[model samples]
Target: MGIKAFLSEPLARYIVAQQHEWIAASREVQEKWRTGLVQKAMNTQFGKDHFFKDIHSYVDFKSAVPVSDYEDLKGYISKIKEGEENILWPGKPLYFAKTSGTTSGTKYIPISKDSISNHINSARNAILTYIAETGKAQFLDNKLIFLSGSPVLTETGGVLTGRLSGISNHHVPAYLRANQLPSYETNCIEDWETKLDKIIDETIDQPMSLISGIPPWVQMYFDRIIARTGKKIKDVFPEFSLFIYGGVNFEPYRAKLFESIGKPIDSIELYPASEGFFAYQDSQDEEGLLLLLDTGIFYEFIPTENFFDENPKRLSIGEVEIGKNYAMIINNNAGLWGYSLGDTIRFVSTNPYRVLVTGRIKHFISAFGEHVIGEEIEKALRYGMERHPEVEVVEFTVAPMVAPEQGGLPYHEWLVEFATLPNNMEQFVQDVDRRLTELNVYYDDLIKGSILRQLVLKPLRKNSFIDYMRASGKLGGQNKVPRLSNDRKIADELTKINQ
Candidate 1:
């Protein structure tokens, strides 16, 4: 791959031009955005009931619309699916993104034309922003691969339902599709194994520069490419430079990816889901994603400590303090008003704000007083992995062992599937357990007080999580192993395979 200077310069300039006023005066921009969005949709059903016209300020908006979730807005969503008009948005959505449901069953999120435009723009801006920051347009010369779901859209109840990545695939311009690897036919393959095999067959010899997808699946793609070619990823794609990942933290996969690629390249993180494109890593100097304040979505933060409260205090962007975990709430052009996305984030910066995704609200283990999250588990795993450089954890998940049936004392149970197993299991156990003790005070106290035993480690059988997801019909595209669970559901399921 060589210079694609002409290709990126115009778009890069356009992005910067659009961002200029917003980046300079984010607070002012945000205030204006809220007003415009509220006023424009004031006649919609939700707006009428919530008194959107009366919401002249953030305080008024907060007072009018309470923090909500899928259940709170399901009535409006149901009407939308039935082709109703002026329910949440002004009219029916162009599509319904069937979420890879958490603990709850399937959720159908509306994707209106306006909302989808916003999603596309935000994602576009992220890549352009990086191009502007790094001044490396050569990477754009080659194909940009999105190891996403199929491009085929499925219609249901007068609205389409599909994975977000697949939905995105449908929107790729015909011109760009020439540069986008993995042809339409390969991407549409229903079974992940077959699809992955096809992707390898199609893109292995192609000039790939940028790769974007959720971390685990992308890793799987890389593994296959490497195994078949018998070469490092860097050699496989000589110009490969950027790997854009979202839906999960990249820290856990960092070491293994580096090992596979044989060298480091620029890695960008995105926070995109069916609901919205929330944030992207604006600067690789700092690891956190810069909050996309001027995107179509208006954000609110509920302190994680009070996240389960019937009425948790919600804080505006300005009101959010640094280093505090908050469950994210949003009011967006999509008609998701005061809706919590069920993800938690911790702020790292306020000026030109940036934040780290800490965990999922539904995916955590707090069997006793010790509340452990994905962030802690990642940190613990990173610590262990760093110590044991020879070993590589391909994937892992944790669940609470809360009863005497499993063991005498209740403790966290980790199921790790190794790419390269640790030479010593005892060393692996000590490394992860020691890190968790250092990272979480409550966990340390529980272990010290004998209220909880040291965390247990279990090696998962090969392809265990993959097999599980496949059986559950969630094998690919944004479906991931829940890093931590409140109960032993995932633990029991995986344990059966090992047995």
Candidate 2:
């Protein structure tokens, strides 16, 4: 069946019809956008009106507005606390998705009712398409396990203010709804700790066919299941057909996960985020085709090389080139216009518009001033792994650390979990270092003498990432473990056990 036929007929028609409306709306917005009207309005509203007096004052005013980091929205957040209308949205937002902030404790991003509805529709469509591709729709009559965040409600006047996940849960299909175990919503437990226990208890004996969530949480659930039942995931759910995951890269956990489940590689990888359900792996071999939720948002790509340059160019959906890294900026109906999500991605093709996510823009190491990005690290790691047939990396993260103890130059410390601990751990580390040096000239210079001390390796258990996530209270649900920690403390804490 074609992509359209794969969707539920009524839903397909609704989405297509909505797409037409969006296209018209987008054209109107883009016209105004090109004229810098949106930026003018936003600046007047957001700033005290003194800044951005004229649109031409800021470069790229049409495609770019003055950047608003998480700190810039504090006043709006305070307004939310005071029960006043916030400037983040055009109208009263239906709900807020609490996301982590670097400096701010937590950021409550507004999601309008319309945006929530769009998210729901996009997610459902992704699932349907996935089922069609895998031919697993036939087997989905059995129960599905969703490892998601518990619905958190803001307490107001002795009552819950907004039950976020509960609203989404209500929209689940009637047939499949009953089969779903008690989520963070139905459980009265407010603490995530208690909610996780409840989720584990509910699924221990259930016949779950499909598992979905951020990878670390799913791994934690699998760990808990094994601990409780003394059986591997394959033993617990022999009929399992799907392992849907998103929110973080799954490459590091692949070997251990596949070994435990005894499932084919195709059983894993699904990409969905809080903003919207973006994409999913269409076929076993094909990298994810980003089915533009054209109805949800208008997409824009800013080339990675241009991000730091004074005069940068942006590409609309049609204009983007394949194999070039770009940062995603979206003008979504959710009230975020020209917002940079800090993720770097590359298009694989444009016909159906397939893309591969490279990594986070902010998550990179440059101890020796080489400006090594996550893409480079992934490439280097993969190359090293391919060369060494005996070793399989289970979990790995690289961090730049001061090396006073090891000769006083900054160094990249690798915390690696291998299938088998290498007899010559130093040799393995040196080999990886050599591979990385070959990839970048600066790395070679740093390694030889100037800036870097030495490549260090700390071996970990196969399930170390899973353990780390569980320990951090991020396991299960929406929260994901970051592959690279810019801060040294988190990275140090992660390496402690291995050391």
Candidate 3:
């Protein structure tokens, strides 16, 4: 084995051993974090206002702090922006993770010195966990490419501000930094296409062992690799053994991505955000990402059905059950109190507390009383594609078609971009609809009641979604096309772009 691989093995084993301890004591670890975080923030303005000192139990914590979105914390965030100290956490945040908001315009999420470790170390531990479990650490010996936003950052309210990926770039350990590609100069380019081109130029001839990015963007990279060299990625990077991805479901992009690579590679999925690094795939044998209980964050779950209710029941780690969808809430060391993450997840295993990201709370199609979620649609499409091995999906989005221009019944419109169109389009549609019906009984009821027609599949022109994203100036960097929408805003734009 090479020097890098030889050294990483022992460290990997130690990390996994430590992780197992926390995983085994999941509930206790969470309780500890909850109590500790509350104590740490007790002197802060938000803590005083929320009566943090009186939070002796989970019930008290819930009563003291209401579940909050970004808007709810904007006041404190605004103060922090203007150089306020000890407003939320113990003191001023190390940085602000700037993200484009839907209703709030631009949001600045604070990253405390204590909390940044979770973001950086959780990622490291994930790799270590993989190395420990699979006994495959040789990837450390070669080049590793992380397709990410520019590391260039600007200041906001005296704090450095940038996308989470860009902020993460600054924290990458010197050891990995030595093997990381494309060069720092290439990573600083603003335009995604130009940066991607530069990345290709820098790494096309290198000994790449791992590629990490959001799936769609990585797919773009693989496509570019193929186009430039007229060879599959595996041919170009024979040692490439791992693909680490997050931000979107991989199933939809899996087939096309593997086709581009000409072979399959092990992959790790991460549940990370501007708020915190939540979970990471810990084992190759496991079906779900292992939820991080000791990560300076306390987690809560509200049944997805009760998410919009006036007083939804919030359950702690010990109270949650497997297989039920819940909207995730977090109270973290970063000073976010009862923060609603806007994402929904289902626990797949309770023994060690592993979860599958089900969908987003707002990214669902509940039009016509048929609540269809991202997971269902992605699963249904995958089910159909499994039957028709010829079909290769590039990208897809579903939106409610409340009214059809041709005067037919309103239906769910699926705008799909196919890399290779199915020979039997009609059969493929029927299979997808069938799977969706089986997965969502409400949708099946709508179809049976004639309240909605069977979903209409609209084939999109090449790079239709890419064009739409580029037009909106959201071509890359953690931006994801919503899988399901209740309205026609994205649908209409996609149609126009396809035209």
Q: What is each predicted model's overall lDDT from 0 to 1?
A: 0.85, 0.62, 0.92
Worst 10 residues of 2 by lDDT: 43-52
The better candidate by lDDT, 1 or 2, is: 1
The candidate, 2 or 3, that scores higher on TM-score is 3
What's the lDDT for candidate 2? Answer: 0.62
lDDT of 1 by residue, 1-499 (tens): 3435567777887887777667777777777778888987899999999998888878798789988889889888887877788888877788888785654578888888888976787777788888888887776667888988776887867888888888988887664667888888888888889999988888888888899988889888888888898999999998899999998888888888888998889988889989988888888687588888887887889999999898789887778898899999988887898898989999998877889999998787888978888899999998888888888877889987878674588888899998888888898888899899998999999999999898888998778888888877888887888888888888898898788
lDDT of each residue in 199-317, candidate 2, tens digit only: 87777677777777766556656666777788888778876777777666676556556766766734545555545555655556677555453545656678887876664676676
Q: Considering summed lDDT, which 10 consecutive residues are worst modelled in model 3?
A: 16-25
The candidate that achieves the highest lDDT relative to the unseen native structure = 3
Which of 1 and 3 is ahead in lDDT?
Answer: 3
Tell me the tens digit of each residue's lDDT in model 3 across 210-294: 9999999999999988988999999999999999999999998898999998888899999999999999999888899999999
Estimate the TM-score of every prediction. 0.96, 0.81, 0.99
Model 1: lDDT of residue 407: 56
Judge candidate 1 at residue 46 and give its lDDT: 93
Q: What value does the lDDT take at residue 88 in candidate 2?
A: 48
